[model samples]
Target: MSGSAVRSLVSALLLMVLLAAAGCAGGKKEPETLTVFAAASLTESFGTLGKAFEKSHPGVTVKFNFGGSSTLAQQIVQGAPADVFAAASPATMKQSGAPSPRIFARNRLEIAVPKGNPAHVAALKDLANPAVKVALCAEQVPCGAAAVKALAAGGVTVKPVTQEQDVKAALSKVRLGEVDAALVYRTDVKAAAGAVEGIEFPEADKAINDYPIAAVPKTAHLVLAREFIDLVLSDQGRRVLTDAGFTAV
Candidate 1:
């Protein structure tokens, strides 16, 4: 009835309307997340790629599950929720049941030693020396399979002090001085950088592993999954992978 009363009522209604609009906007702002399952050897490169993808695609978040290729592949096969699968080996990819996989990169095994090469491991054969404690990836992992092939090519047989589940774990043994040396991917040794030194062996060429990537058929976000895979196969992704020591496929 009064002018001041009417003005107060109008202000209350306007505040309620603004609050309602804010609620609606908040409800509509849901982030898009893309889940990627990748090999442990790809940790560094894929981490960089994921961040880059997030920056380039606003409102999209990239999440990665990095582990041994065999382990990751098995996880995918067991109905794990993943939008994409990036494996370190075709064998693992095939086991994962991810269709239409494309080889994105290649990697070879290298002997990784402590930063100072305390054990003075000079070659692959040296790993066979009973005095040198060595670590290797388990037979199930891609790196382990490569290591076995490389050792056979070099006519060397090593009894590793420990067999790790992944290349990174094997490398970690060298870094922590738990083992005098370990066989891991060149990319992994590069990722370890100053923490470990990579020793290139002639036999490594015989056991190069191909890294493949594919989108999961049951991906909830098909478009985003495809886009992420495309980005990984792009020039920028190649640059990142190369920087991390992966050879382009």
Candidate 2:
């Protein structure tokens, strides 16, 4: 072949090779991300479940947005992109308008005190004492509502030094020694066992919160959402939650 003809042929072959490389690259799909909006209390257990799910599901990533159930519900209602929601209460789950939410676990409140129980907060009523500085979740959140119910059941009215937006924030007060005591979920206390002590009160039973999980109505990845929920409700999910101090339903 002439020099110009040979050059033209080489250019054509190079173009074909580039096109073939592009086709192969396109054939390998990018990983899909499954976003979950879950209650702050579910952080530990869900973290474990997310890793397990990613291992079982290749080319898929589990992303979590953990916060107060009420806040998470409002976000979903406001059109935040989410695949699934795990709420700390059915009431919060309903607010999200996620169809067919199912209860997966239950949690109860406990008095979280500093490592040594510096305030000597023994029972629910102790929180009412003026000498005790307490932190509590706001009433709009599940933990806060449960705290209100538990306090009412014990006929104890407390004025917390601060009202946190989520259970983790409230628990952080105790962990940081910023507050003498805080009313938080049993699971949170368990997760922070080294930083605080859980004082179980009889009144907590009256305010046990039922956790619910469901795929969001507008989920983009419907199949992945359902699969993640399945994993959360599976036997392994139960063991993870139970180990984290949540009562399996």
Candidate 3:
């Protein structure tokens, strides 16, 4: 080929390469990250969902902080950098001013006893017996409120050996056999996956706990947060929650 023609061909190839490189490096997209604050009761479900969310959204990371709903709400109020908050109760969601939340699932209180029913806690009234050594959640928690309502519905008055701050703590007492029996959400008991045995009482229906989820106001990953929230309310999310023993809300 002639020298001039060869030079022109080289220039054209270089220009095309530059344009392709520019397209590949467009804007240096920032990594997407989402931080979720969920209730202790949602530990298992959210853990599963977090993994799924991350897998579905490449270049995105989903971080979860599972704890008492009240504690999570307080953290968000204290300026914690949470993108999403899922509370086991509506009262905890009330603390977030970001946006209105929607109910995602519901759970009911159940009597969790050690395997083999060592405490002989056959019914709700049996929990009132002084010898049963019941473990209960503190009044500030949703499970505790359900416990109180279930007790009142059954006309049972009893003092618990211990009051836990969260449902898992209460369930741990039962699993460790530290307490004879404790009241925890049925979904929690289910998530425990046989670590503890659950007993359903007639009054449990009166004390069902509702779970609500919302995006935080100052989320750095608002788009992803909203997407995660949408996923939780999706049919697939509902199926997962139901499989974990939560009722549709």
lDDT of the candidates, in the order given: 0.91, 0.95, 0.89
- Residue 156 miss distance in model 1 (angstroms): 0.7
Per-model TM against the reference: 0.88, 0.90, 0.90
Q: How many clashing residue pairs are found in candidate 3?
A: 0
lDDT order, best first, reads 2, 1, 3
Query: Per-residue CA lDDT of candidate 1, range 1-249, in tens?
Result: 999999999999999999999999877547889999999998999999999989988888998999998998888889999999999899999999989999999998889999889899999999999999999999999999999999999999899889999988899888899999999998988888688998999999999999999998699998989989998899998999999999986
- Model 2, 1-249: lDDT tens digits are 899999999999999999999999988668899999999999999999999999999899999999999999999999999999999999999999999999999999999999999889899988999999999999999999999999999999999999998999999999999999999999999998578999999999899999999999979999999999999999999999999999997
Model 1 RMSD in angstroms: 4.2
lDDT of 3 by residue, 1-249 (tens): 999999999999999999999998985566777999998988888888888898898888888888888878888999999999999889879976658899999999889999889868889999989888999999888889889989999999979999988999999998898999999998888988888899999999888888999999888778899899998999889888998898975
Worst lDDT 10-window in candidate 3 = 24-33
Error of 3 at 184 (Å): 0.3
C-alpha positional error of residue 72 in candidate 2 after TM-score superposition, expressed in Å: 0.8
